[model samples]
Target: GPPRGRELEVARLVRQLARERIHNVVFTAADVHYAAAHYYDPTRAQFRDFEPFWEFVAGPIHAGTSAPLPMDNTFGPQVVFSKGAPPGQTLSPLAGLQFFGQLDVDSRSRTLTVQLKDASGQAIYRHTLQARRA
Candidate 1:
């Protein structure tokens, strides 16, 4: 969501991926300084065709940290889980809010599980999604 030359490019790519029959699409990025989970449902949006997908964000492994940004909801994403450092608290290992994310893909089971964890490896949130049938 950072200053990309054309923001529409992101949506175009997402549409292409969906049109190509891609499933379980997920996006991850660092340096956002927070941890949160969101799900995008095409049925809930004005523009249709894109399939539902999940977005998990985790970051600030050691650098400066901040709170999770408010959801834009342009893509009809529902906030599944979200955690942020309290006001006046620095997001870091010492603050016990610094976090990371893990993604497990089981081809045999056709399942994907995402987890966000703290420095001690305790899960703050977990989500499992199964691939839809053709």
Candidate 2:
């Protein structure tokens, strides 16, 4: 959720979806100074690999220190909680997901449409959201 374009936005969206499902989380650990992230995978009904999506977020981590200083390698993001909610109610972690796809809304129909594509402009995901007026 740095100062990068679309990254933070996608993070926010992802966070919202997670919240809708009542999930808590940490964040992507860029260095060796952060706690691990956590999320429960509904599809598998178990814990799954948690990683932050970034420009470098998606790929390998390259650690380079000063000409004289040595550094340790990182293994990417970690998921702390895989299942079950904690006792009582608690505030949720921040969701910093911004979608990389096109989003459209129909005001009259109260419907939302999302179109997703891969890096090569191939369609990957498409979803439509509609609500009946109460």
Best by lDDT: 1
Residues 1-134, candidate 2, lDDT per residue (tens digit)? Answer: 12145444644565564555532222232332111223323333222222232211110122221111221112222243111113232222222111124557788887765554333445445555564333
Model 2 residue 130 CA deviation (Å) reads: 0.6
Off by over 4 Å in 2: 1-99, 132-134
Model 1: per-residue lDDT, tens digit, 8-91? Answer: 686788789888988767887665777888888877655455788888988778766676666654566788888887656565
Please give each candidate's TM-score: 0.83, 0.27
lDDT of 2: 0.32
Task: For each candidate in the order shown, give its overall lDDT on alpha carbons.
Answer: 0.76, 0.32
Clashes (backbone N, CA, C under 3 Å), per candidate, total 0, 10
In terms of TM-score, how similar is model 2 to the real structure? Answer: 0.27
